[model samples]
Structure formats: C-alpha cells, structure tokens
Target chain A: MDTWEKLDIGLVMTVLGMGIVFLVLIFLSSLLGFFERLFGTRRSPAAQEPKPAAPAAAEEKPPPLPRPPSKPAPEPAPAAAAPAALRPAVVAAVMAAVSAYLQAEALALEPPVKRLPDDLSFWGRAARLDQMMARRL
Target chain B: MSIGESILRFLETMGFAAMTWQQAVMIGVACILIYLALKKGFEPLLLLPIGFGVLLGNLPLAGLMAPPVYETVIDPRTGQAVQEMKEVGGLIYYLYQGIKLGIYPPLIFLGVGAMTDFGPLIANPRSLLLGAAAQFGIFTTFIGALLLDFLPGISFSPQEAASIGIIGGADGPTAIYLTARLAPHLLGPVAVAAYSYMALVPLIQPPIMKLLTTKKEREVVMEELREVSRTERIVFPIVVTAAVSLILPAAAPLVGMLMLGNLLREAVSMQPILNRLLKTAQNELINIVTILLGVSVGATASGPLFLNPRTLGIILLGVFAFAVGTAGGVLLGKIMYRTSGGKVNPLIGSAGVSAVPMAARVSQTVGQQYNPSNFLLMHAMGPNVAGVIGSAVAAGVLLSMLG
Candidate 1:
C-alpha cells in the first residue's frame, strides 16, 4: 500500500486540530467566568435604589393644583376680561381690589333708601374671603 | 531595413508578441473576477485589485511581478564569488515581500481588532466552543487533500496541505499568512479561495445551517446578554494577549497584534491623539495594505500556475472546509441546545465558521425566517468573534508543526 493509503494523517489532523481548538476556546470561556468571579459585579443604574426617591419630603407633599375663580361679581361685567397671561395670584388680587372699589362706588352712587338692611355683612364677608385667599396663595 | 525585419520589430512591442495561450486565459479569468467584483459584488475591495493585478501580471513583457535576479560579484579579499540579488524588482514583486515575510496579515489583524466589538463574546463566553468547533472544516479538508493525491497534477505535501486547509477558516489574512509561509507558490489560489468563500458566507452557510438545525431549535429565544462591565472589556484583550502568547508563541504575532488593536480601541485612559493615530491604522493603513496585498497575491496567479489541477483541488477543498466547518458548528450548537434544555439556538453554531459579522448576520436572517421576533445577531456574534481567535490558534498550530 502507498504511504498515503497506509497513513490516516487526515483523520489524525482532523481529530487533533479540532480537539486543540476546542480545548483552547473552552479554556478561554472558563477564564471569562474566572475573571467575572475575581472582579465583583458592577451595579447598573436600574439595579440601584431609585436614588432615595428624590428627597423624601418633596415626594410626600405635592404642589397645590390651581383653583377656578369664584362667581364673577355682578356689577355690569367688564367688556374685556383681564389678559390671561397674568399669574393666578395677581389676577385674584386685581379682581378683589376691583370688586371692593366697585362696591364702595355703588354705595356712594345708589339711593340711600334702596340699600338693604345690614349691608355691613357684605364688607365683613369680603374681609373673610380675603383672609381665605391669602392662606391658599 | 528589410520589410520582414521591420514587421518583426514592430510586433515585439505589442502585448500579443510574447503572450501565451495560458496567459490569455488568465486575463479572461481576471476579467471575470473584475466583473464579479463590480457587478456581482463579490468581495469587491480585494477582488477588484486582485483581478487588475492578474491582468497586469499576465501582460507580455509588463515585468510587474518578475522574479529577483542575482548578479555574481568577485570578492577581492576572499577571491570568491559572492552573489548579490537585486533588491528591487517590479511593483507587485516589491509588494509581495510583505506577504512573503508574513508582515501584512498580522497588521491587518490589528485593524480588525480595533474595529471589532467583543461584548457579545464576553457576555456569553460559551460561544468560544462553537468558534472552536467550526474549525473542523480545516482539518477535514487537510485529510481530503491527502486522499485526493491519486489524481494527476494534484499532489500536496503535508505543508501544502496545511496551507489549503486554512482556507476553510474563511479568514483571508490567516490563509495568506499560512500559504505564504508553508507553500508560497500557492498563495494566490489560497487567498482568492479564502476571500471568495468569506464573501459567500451568507449563501454557503444557510443551507448547512438549516439542514443541521430543527425548526424548534431555530426558534429558541435566548436571554438578553448581561451588561458587561467596562473594566471587563478593557481587561479582555490584555488577558487574552498574555495567556495566548505565553501558551502559543507561534500565535503571538497575530494574536498579540489583534489584542493590541482591541486594547488601543477600548482603553479609556488612552490619549485622544494616540487613539486617533491608532484609528488611522484601523482605517487608512488597513485599506492601503489590503490593496497592496490583494494585487500582489493576484499577480502570483499567472497562467501555468493557476490553471493547474492542484489549484482546482485547493478550491474544491476550500469549499469542503467551509461546509464541514458550518456543519461542525451546527452540530456543537445542537449539543449545547439539548444540554441547555433548548435555550441555545443551533443557528448560531454556523457563525462559528468565523466570517465575522456576515456569518452572524446569516444566523440572524435564518432565525428570523422561522421566528421574526428572535434576535440572534448579538448572541451569534459571541461565537463569530470567537471563530477569529480559534482560527488564529489553529494557524499557529499548523505553522508550528509544518513550518
């Protein structure tokens, strides 16, 4: 038989070559695991506590929602409403000042006989509304 | 001058004057390769240059890749003849020295390393085994080459056999490196075969991948890769370099350069200027070297050498190597799949053949065909990159034994 026929070099190489490569890679895979164990895991942002919930007191108390304005006082309603751009507090203050002024003007202009009994309640009620608005603001 | 003499003189300067039938055939082959590169888009980057080089080399009296000549010099002191070979020859001849000295391949590996991402491999290290398994093609082809010796004009020594076997690795540089060292004459066919197969990865790998895997195995959904630490990514190349170089010194140049490129790319502390310089190596240097290497390699495939039966044998064996490699990876993948209780998708095993992103992409495409939701690209990359290392190690082994 020829040397090529007699020897199974191909078979030998196949086994030997594949075997060596597999073993080396297997070693590398194991090395990766070993490295991971040696170096402790690095924590991801998601894994950490949600940053202590952004200062606990801020979380417990929410900001107050805006309230609708009370029924518009009935003198002849102004033709043009105040611009909507103003801050809520400024708008409320302006409306109160205007209401008080208008009520005083009406008291001066209206006939004394037509004035209702105990009109002092109107002033007292307005004062109470001012106090409530101040606390809310 | 006589009319006949004038005609002969005129004919001498033309390409056809000295061109052989075989040379003409090689030019045709070159044209075909060029067409494949431009139209078919078959590894155009390397094939285009190679095809042009083939045309340049085979042209009569072009002298682009002629052999170096030695001149006899009389030494006065010893009164003896000292031969001095011409240092420079043709352009392609000069470029071929890079391949001959085994320099270009390692440098190319550096570029590859800089560009490649090893996160997938790091995320799931078990993919290394699949990478290793895919190399089964190389050895099987080696055996097949030896068996085919009975055919006329197709004889290979163990060294040539080793060179041919590496083409199955589907890595162009590794094939060129091994062939240039072990069988320099065979470099052209081996390189062309290797790159051609690499380009054909999508077409070649899928059929074998599907045959070896089942529908259920293909549909297997793998868990998301864990977040690999930056420290681990940084340490990986360094650790691999130290370990592989120490163990296999023959592999040091290829492996060390690859790791160095990766380290240069990944290091957080590296200066921006230096990193940019390394990036130039990854982009510009690699492109230039690739052009030079491809053309030089193609120049070696002149008529008589390339048209031989041995070249055919090598090409055939190359395909065999790729097929067997794909099969080997899938088989191993099947084993892992069964062992892991069906968590592992066998399609990823085909990526072990090491065409890099292409092989991994083939895995993704095939897996998606079965189940569109399955994202195997990242998972497949683990083994894909692993195949690069595995083949380099295999090349080291072959060089140590045969070289």
Candidate 2:
C-alpha cells in the first residue's frame, strides 16, 4: 500500500487508463469477428470426422440398458423357478435396483452389453474384434 | 479568499487533484463491469456483485462501500447510539476479510465436497491422471509469471507466483483460499483471473480441444460403467474423506463436505435429508455465496488495486493457463483412446478443468453432436470430478510448500 500510495499517478487516473484498454479490447474483438466472416476457411468434409456409419448399426451390440443378464438357461433355472413366497422379495429387490438406475438416469453408453462370461476357452480362442464388438467404428 | 475559505479551497484543490472527471469515468467503468456481469451470463453471480462493489467501494463520500471498520451509529427511537456500528465491517470489508483471512473458501470447499460425485472419477482412475496433467497449466503459469517482471508493477515471489498459478485450475474458491493464505496482496488479481477465465471456459476450451484431438478421436465412445454397488458407493465418500483428510489436512474441510454430500445422496436411507441438502446445494447456499463471492471478489478490483499492468498480465496468463489445462486433458484423452483402442472419447478429456460438471456437461453436449448415440457424461464425469480433487491436491502442495 505504501508503494501504491507512492506511485505518481492517482487512482482515478489509473482507472481511466484501464477503461481505455478495456474499450480497445472490446473493439478489437468485434473487428476480429468481422474478419473471421470475411476470410475464415470454409467447412470441409474434413471439418467432421467419419465414424462407422452403417457398420456400427450392424453390431448386435451390448444391450442398451443395465439389464441383469438373462437368468441363466442352465438347469439351475429351478432357482429362478423357486417358490412364489421367496420369489416376491427377490423380484422387489431387482425392481428397486432397476428403478434406482432409471431415477439416477444412468447414461448407458449407447447399449450396455453384458461382458461375456469368464471361460478359458473363450479367452484362448477369442473371436476377432469385429465378432465380439458387433459394431465397427 | 478569507482564511477559512482559503483552507477549504486548498483542501478541495488537493482532493480535485484526483480530478472528478477521472473518478466519474472510473465509476462508469465500474458500472459497465457490473452490467457485463449481470446482463451477460459471464459469471453474473460473482461478477455482478464484484462490479457493483467496485463501483460502490471507490465512490467518494457515498459512505456505503467501506464504512470504517467500526463507525458511529444512531438509534433514533432510543435517541442514542444504542448499537454502535462496532467495526462489524461493511459487506465488502467483511468479504475482503474473508479472503484475507481465508475463511469462507475452505468452508465453500466443504459445501462443494458435499455436492460433488466422485463415482465417475472412481470408476475411471485414468481420469485422475488427466486431471493431474491439467495441473501442469498452473505451474506453467507460475513460470510465465516469473517472466512477467518485464510487465509493469508486478513482481511476485515464488510462493506468490505459485498461489497465482492455481488460477489455472479454474476453481475460484480454491484459488481464493490458496492465495488468501499464501499471498494476500495478490488475491485481488488472482481471484479476478480465476473467475473471469472460468466464465470464458466455453470460449477458451473448444479451440484447444479441437486443435489437440482428431475428429476420429472425438467420436470414440467409452464402454458402459458397471453398476457401482450401493455399498461401494457408500464406501466411496467415507474412504475419500478419510484418505484426503489424513493425507492433506488442508483439503479435509473441502473433501469432507463434498464426500459428506455424496454420502447423503448415496446412503439410500436418508431421502428426506438428501432432499434438504440437494435443495440447499441447488438454491440457498449457491445463491447467497454467489452474491457475496461475486461482489466481494469484484471489490478487490478497486481502481488502484486492479488498474495495473500486472492485472492485465494475469488475465492473459489466465487464458494461457486454461488453454494449457484443456490441451493436457485432450492430449491425455488421445493417449487413453489409443491405449483403449478408441474406446475413450477424447472430448471427455476437456472436463479436466474442474468447473464442477459444467465442463463435463460441455463435453457431453459436444460429443452428442459428433455421435447421437454417444453417452460421455459419466465418462467425462471421471475427469470432471478428478479435476476437483486435482485442484485441491495442488492447493495442498502450495500450502505445504509455501503455507
């Protein structure tokens, strides 16, 4: 503050000085706007990137929502077929979880796919990227 | 002139040494700043108040701006000065006190913590790296500031420079809190720089984001996130609060509030509490602080304090810092895209500036333009949220190094 007070110019003068600078900046910004319209390069195809237009559509794709994977078709299907009294609570639990996701508006990236089950055979002889991903970008 | 008249004349002349025209013009400029802040959505919350505060603080004999820290007051009904205006401090004075003593900002961090969502960041730990990368801009600005001795009326020590550098994070509360502690004098410039550039993020980020990432890169879509289990969600806030508090005691207040808010939201049993907190976060707290923060921050821009070449230098350096942060985010995004075989939308990289979901929203908005099916918000949230932690960590480093 002592140094500030010792400065030769008064505060009002300093403010006035900056006000001029602000005006110049505003004016220059407007001038650039005019020139940009006059000489800016035209938008080209390169202006936008290409994606896997049709091929991405073909991807069997992950299910779009967070769905619990289909109840296993394996013979353990009786567990899903359990008695009605026990099933009601299980069904309510599932509904609540699903509702929570919906309420949170959890954005599923395009389609949510269940990651394939873990298996040494699947891992050892994995299908090509296109076979697994379904969509090609 | 008579002796009394002559004394009056001499004083008036001395006062007029400032020139009424210049003062009036300064006041006009202050009003214009106020108008831009209010009329333009350019940080209207803080800018409007700050601009008005600047105008009011500088006006002579308006007697409103900075009432003497303590002043005489009268109670007409009681016919007494019953309640002395005991240096309770004028609004801007109190605000400046908050900044000077570093009071409100840390509390603000607590509120911010309560409002934040760390899940996205937790889901994608790599966003933390991008967030950290963006912090490079803060230090870069510090180096740029070192070179700014060539500018007029600006010479910051290393600590002061570091305080100013955190403005690159584009987190106003943290910047103010940090500067208030490390370099109280530069708080005026640093706060101005942080808030002004934050308002300019839309204008500043897109160009750098475009320049750094290819069109293909922008269109990359991230895989869906797994269900972050309820217990996993609940543990997030508790663990982070403990981790951050134990690790960086300075960041505890902010992290605690933020995580506490998330805890409220995730606890699942506290719907009423969540409703109350969510409403306050969205409305009351934001509105009140925004009014105070904006104006008070603006008040720092009093004609003398703000009307310097250093302030100008800070503004320019601020843009550079923002650009650097954007560049870092997008570039790291490109790297992630490559490593993941184009599974990451580099646009999410731009969310690394920690504008609290705004930058993340921008990434989501822009990505949808490139690919209608793209859902980048949660992905962007990773870096967007990490940017908050990143800035807090940066603040901790500055405090420890220069506290």
Candidate 3:
C-alpha cells in the first residue's frame, strides 16, 4: 500500500485502541472517587484548602493591638538590630509569617472573641497564628 | 529453488519487498509489542495494538497492504468496510500516515500538559536554571552525532544531528516529532530508544543520582512550597505558550497544545465545566494519541531498512545521549549545592534532565535513603518541571537552526 493509506489505517487502529484504555482509566478514577464519597475515606494531596472564612476575618481584621505590644516584644527588636546581610528578605518574611501565625492562634481560643469591643485587630492576628501553628499538628 | 530461496522468490515475484525469513521475524517481533502492551502492561496502552497492526502488514499474500506489485486484495477479514480491501493498502501504511503528517505527536503533547504541574517550578525559579543546565546533553549529543560523519550512510548535518540527539532527553513524543521533522530516516531507532530508556528511568537514574550526590547532600530537607495563587497558575501556561510560539513557530503546535491543557487545569473558576468536559470527552485524549503514536512509530520499522547498521548506531547514540544528560544535571547540581552551601540539595540537580516527575521522585527517594526524615519531593519537583520547559525551549532553538 501507499504511505498515506498505510498511515491512515495505523492511526485509526491506534487511536481507537488507546481511547478505550484511557476511558477505562477515567472510569476507574471516578469510581474510586465515588467510593471515597460513600464508604471510603480519601486523602487529597492539597493542603490548607479551607482557611476558615470567619477565622480568616480575624486574621485580616486585627494587627494593631498585637502590633503595639509586639513592638515591645524583645525578638522583633533584636531583628531591628541585626545587619542587613543577616536578615534577608526571606528570613524577614519567615519571621513575620511565624509571628502572624502565632497571632492568629491566639485569637481562635474557646471564647471565640465574643464581645471584646468593636476593634478586634489583635484577636484576628491571634486567630491566623492559631491556624499556622495548627498546620504543624 | 531451495525451500528458503523458493519462499524468497515467491515473495519477490509477489512484490512482498522483503525476504520471507525477514518478514516472519518482524512479524514475530510485532507480536512481542502486542504482548508487552496487553499482558505485561509495559506501555501496553500504546504498544499492544501497534504490534498487531504491524504484524498484519508484514503477512504474505494478505494484501492487507498494497504489496506494490499487484493492486490486489485477498480476503484478510477483520470485516470492517475498509477491510473489504477494494485495492491494496497495508495496515502499516495507515499507521504510518499519522506520524508523517505530524498529527499524533502534538495531540500526545496535549495529554502531557494535562498531566504536568508547573507550580513547583514557579515556587522555585532557581530550578529553571537546573532544567536549562540538563539540556547540555541534547546539544552535546548533536555534536557527537555530527562527528560521526566519518561513518558511511550515517552522517547528520546540524539539523539532523539536533533532531537525533533529542533521544537522550527521554521524551518519546517530542523526540518523534522532532525527528519526523528534521531527520525522518532516523525516526524508528530514535523513538524506540526514547521510550525504552524512559521506561528504564527508574533503573538508570538512581545509580547516577547515588554516585553524584554525597549522602549528606541527599538528606537536605527543603522548605515546603508556599501557596501559589490560582491567578498565577492560570497565567503561566498562556505566558509560556505565547512567548515560545513567537520565537519559534515550528515548536508552536506541540508546545501550544501542552500549554493550553495546563491552562485548562489551572483556570479553577472553570474547573466544574472543564472537569465535566474532560470526563465526557477530552481525558481519553491521552490513551488514544499514545496508541496512534506508538503504532505509527512501529509501522515505520520495515525489515531490511529497520535492521540496518544506522539503526544500531542510533541505539548506541541514544544511550550516550541519556547518560550525558544525566551527568550534566548531576554535576551542575553538585555545583549549586556547593555554591549555596548546605542550603541546596545536590540530588535535585540530577532531576534537571526533563524526565518529568519521575526523575524528581528518584532524587527524593535517594535523599530519603541518606536521611530518612529528609523530604525533597517538592524541591526536586522544581527542577523536574523546569526540565520539561527547558527541553521544550532547547527543542525550539534547534528547530530554528535546522528546520
């Protein structure tokens, strides 16, 4: 047979066959997902997907109260003294992230910041810090 | 005529084009591909039926093909209308067409994009440099193959050399697409080598990864990846595809398809629609193209031509290319480790050769052996994904020079 004719046959056969196999795979994955939804428990690969929308509010809303206090906390003060080379952007970001996570944790206590006045900025930072620390667990 | 010569003369007179012995042997070999695909599941998703189609073409008097001598078809009944065999067209003829037209290879790239994750690379942009470093093997092999100008019937100009050297990257579809474009003659051996060695990545990479990385370096635990925004993921593939296509039009089809698949995935706002569409329609796109691509590759392996000395040279060169790519990644990884001083893990360097997540997994696995607590998967993935982009870029560069 000519080259084109030969290629056409091969293409049809291959696509058809492989298509069947791929469908089987998707079918299986869906079935697996279905089973997980029913009787089985499935662990997804992604982490930190649900950031507790209310807690996130606490995170975004409050920082100034903890801020003036953290202003006096000895650690952020030492960072102020360190040389620029010693405290790179990454290191600073990491420190802030840790501090932020700690502040978030402080806000998520059992009381849930009920009636702590209109300004709950400190409580929000404490809540975010709680989530960050909880991530380790 | 003796039994052998009589069989040969009959086949020659019949215009079968190959000696009966050679035809029989190739037919048997085709059966093996089918077995590997169907039973052993060694890339059976692609190989199994490709093998059967190849066997059908090589059979005597079947006229499952246009035997070149007579425009005739005896009843070789699979009973499809096309199987009624009005004239002559071999099974191989049909399979070969998709490859020559550059159809199946690009579609295969679409599936790859759907499977890949560029998040790791973006999270660690330095890994992009590692991916670029690994591409040294591709160019190095090009020079190596070109230097083989001393061999008869086996010389490669710059473009042909670039095309052939890509076998070392261990990316089957890309290698096929490039060779089909730049050096069609070398396509058969090159594709075979690319697939086989890629399957062997689990076997090949660990040793090199072990040799190059000191145990202490392997155990370096990397910081976890920070969250990448959905917006960034959506933008990445589009940016890469548009940037690459503008520079090298030849690579656009394959690269463009891959990037689109990635975009489809990361556009989370459209996830429900995409998930439904993928489930109902496009997800199987992966298997279908693999089967078509595999058989098309196999159909090109005609007996005398397929068994020639040049094919053997390619097999040898393919191994050389794979090794060189691995070494380049490992050596550079070590350099980065030293330069970064304990902060960088040298094992990640070996993942730069674009075998995708497989190479990265090996880096992580080896790292675990040194320090059981060392977790390098996320870090290794950075270079692994970058290797994919790097190889694609390198491919574009070569096509411009040669195509």
Q: Which candidate is the best by lDDT?
A: 1
Relative to the real complex, the DockQ score for model 2 comes to 0.02
Q: What is the C-alpha lDDT profile of model 1 across B1-52, one tens digit per residue?
A: 9999999999998888889999999999999989989998899988998888
State every prediction's TM-score relative to the real structure.
0.80, 0.66, 0.66
Model with the higher TM-score, candidate 1 or 2 = 1
lDDT of 3 at B383: 80
DockQ of each: 0.20, 0.02, 0.02
As a TM-score, model 1 comes out at 0.80
Highest DockQ among the candidates is held by which one? 1
Fnat for every candidate: 0.54, 0.00, 0.00
lDDT of 3 by residue, B312-366 (tens): 6677787777777787778878887888876788888778777766778777777
| Number of the predicted model whose TM-score against the real structure is largest | 1
Candidate by candidate, in order, the iRMS in Å equals 9.3, 19.5, 16.5
**Candidate 1 regions with alpha-carbon error over 4 angstroms:** A1-7, A40-137, B1-7, B75-80, B84-88, B268-270
Question: What value does the lDDT take at residue A41 in candidate 3?
Answer: 23
lDDT at residue B155 of model 2 (Cα atoms): 66
